[model samples]
Target chain A: MKKILLALSLVMIGIAYHNNVKAQSEEELVQICTMVAGDAEYLKDFRIKLDAGDPPPVQRFPVVLKKDVKYRFSVCNSKDYEGKVILQLFDNNRQLATTYIVATGKDYPYIDWVCTKTGAYHLVYSFRDGKAGLAVGLLSMVGTM
Target chain B: MIKHRVILYQALIIVLLSQVLSSCSFCSRQDVDLSQELIVPDSVIQNSTPQVSKAITDQMMQNISSPVETAALIKGLKIPFNKNFLASTKQADWFNTNFEKAFALGLYGCDLGYLNMYEKTSFVVDYISVIKRLADDIQVGQFFDFSTLKRLATNNENLDSLILISQQSFNRIDTYLSETNRSMLSAVIVTGVWVEGAYLSSRVAQISNHPKIRETIGEQKVILNFLLALLKVYDNDPSMAKLITDFEPIKKLYDQVHITYELGEPEMIEENGVVTFKQTDKQVIEMDDELYNKLITNIQELRSNLLKL
Candidate 1:
């Protein structure tokens, strides 16, 4: 009976510690996002943590972009992780904007998009050089056109 | 006697383990069997189960627009705040069912967004109190840091934090609901927010014919289509069925409205080393005044029906 109780207590403690760590990491990520949000009205935020062992090439999230509204997509990488993120806004026809400039080999922290079409637009987040990473993405409405 | 005591302790441990294990996946065999029986053919019952398409649910979850933006846009027009357009806070306790509570929570969230944007700090506490009650009723109250939100709402200087924190609270609740397979509740909340938002915008448009308000009203046609598709995914639920029925008239009215985009030369400007790609494209929303009036009328009726529901 003592052995069983000990095992259960260990499991409970492990679970609690795991949850606390996760909550702290997420809170830190959200704080980074809030700092980057600037004067834009907060709409939605995306929290991305990729497996370090085998990270995917890209993670895609769909957002319904309204016509004639200026939107800002901001990204910040967790300092604990080595990976820097590249955020892209695109649809079926063309890539509207991206944070990393391929030719310049540079990355901006955010992408400002004045959406013309009211449809499902994709926000693709990927680590620079396809490295594993943790990042947070924020979507804010700058204004209506 | 010690042996008997040990046996009792072992039995209690077994019961506790079973409860814990049962709470995890693979324990709900009855539910799994029932679902399988409904879909699987007799010959392949042991081998196959139908896969649910996550596309509709995904789109539905993604399409939940922030009412704060709508409220902000309304504020941009310099319109006076009308308390009449808001859902009654007195009806907070009146919602007994999970469906009604979740829906009313959405309504109050929208109203709170409006109140926050308009800087009505004094009236904000009432909405926040009712919001807490409804949120608690639905068992998602943990996501809301009520004390922090209350403090922010009480201070006019903290409007920005109030809006961000409130939106974050809703976002957290939504994420929780989705993760826990309680997406039906999340969908209802989205529906509530959308309806309340549309009602507020249209009501303002009726009083003052602002072009931006009209355009916002017209944009709802696109959002309405997405909302309808989302709601249709759960049409099996009676509450959802009624919601769909209530919204159909508004949808029909919106169908007559036209939104066409004229692509312009995209302009890329860099300010302080920050690049902004401004699409010179213009979206022309062509809706006759008659159809706009009809849409507004139907939306009002839908809101009325929802409040009673």
Candidate 2:
């Protein structure tokens, strides 16, 4: 019985330690994602951890966007990450609609687009520089007009 | 006698070490058969960064299907909530086991979003209670601020607040599950939501000839494939095995779907000194009516297996 108890206690300790690291990463993700989400109602967030590179590979999220429906796209990068992230929105025909990375100085916080056509669209994101970073991408609907 | 005690202690330590290694894989799965070990390496899981095909990457990017977004879209289209498509909250208690509760949590999450979208305040309470109950049962109850959620649901007018709070609630739950190494629950909960959402979408598409809805269902072929791969990570569990069995044909149906890509010239625009670039890649999906009917049938079939279990 004593041996059994010892084993059980060790297992608990291991689990507790594992949870601590996971929690810290998640906390960072939530804080960053909330910034991109802004005042718009939160929908979901994608947490990306970049490996060392000139440019981290782009991440893509596909959703069915409707015509005349306004949607919000935002990005939040970790402080340690070397640079910002650029988010691009593409229509079914592969036409770029509103892209945050290319809009002006490549430092805009988010994209608020009123989709003119309805179909499948991709929300693509990548770190501005490949210096290995952690970032969160957020998506929300601003309600239809 | 002391020597025997030492030997037993050493054996116990070995057993405990194995448990420690596998615990997060579903450490406390009392009722689940443990004959098959959960075997997934950290390196193989692309949960943090998916470098797969665009189809597979989009599916993983979702991580959790946006039933709430779907609800919003339906509302934007001026469609009424077809309560018939939703699983009943009355069945909440029927999901007594961990697997059942986790799966049902996904199902009810869909119902809750639909209810919130329609501003069906009165119906939200029972669903919230059931969701709380399931979350509590799974030991992730702390993530859901039930009282605050209930208060938000009761107001009826703070639609935006309610949406935000609810999104935060699920976000917290998912994060806690990930943080605490309860990824199995996360997997099932996500699968449950995806299955329910797909089921709802497929059913709605059947009732109406909405092109967008049909396209949505067709597009799910990509997601369904990725979902199957995620399930393979847990294929050792009996419940997961059953799920894998149920979802196989759905995968085969989706295998028939072919999406073609046509890349157009990229355009760069300068507006008010803001530089924006547009992707010129267009995709054309070819799926026949027979395949569509088969796809709906398989999607519904998958959900039916989920709920019936």
Off by over 4 Å in 1: A1-15, A52-56, B1-52, B55-62
Q: What are the per-model numbers of colliding residue pairs?
A: 0, 10
**Each prediction's TM-score versus the true structure:** 0.84, 0.67
Q: Which candidate is the best by TM-score?
A: 1
Per-residue CA lDDT of model 1 for B254-304, tens digit only, reads: 768877766566677779977898766677888888888888888888888
Query: Distance from true position, residue B134, model 1, in Å?
Result: 0.8
**Model 1 TM:** 0.84
Clashes in model 2: which pairs?
Answer: A54-A130, A93-B282, A94-B281, A96-B278, A102-B275, A103-B275, A104-B274, A104-B275, B23-B27, B264-B280
- By summed lDDT, the worst window of 10 consecutive residues in model 2 chain A runs over A92-101
Q: What i-RMS does every model get?
A: 10.2, 10.3
Q: Enumerate residue pairs that collide in model 1.
A: none
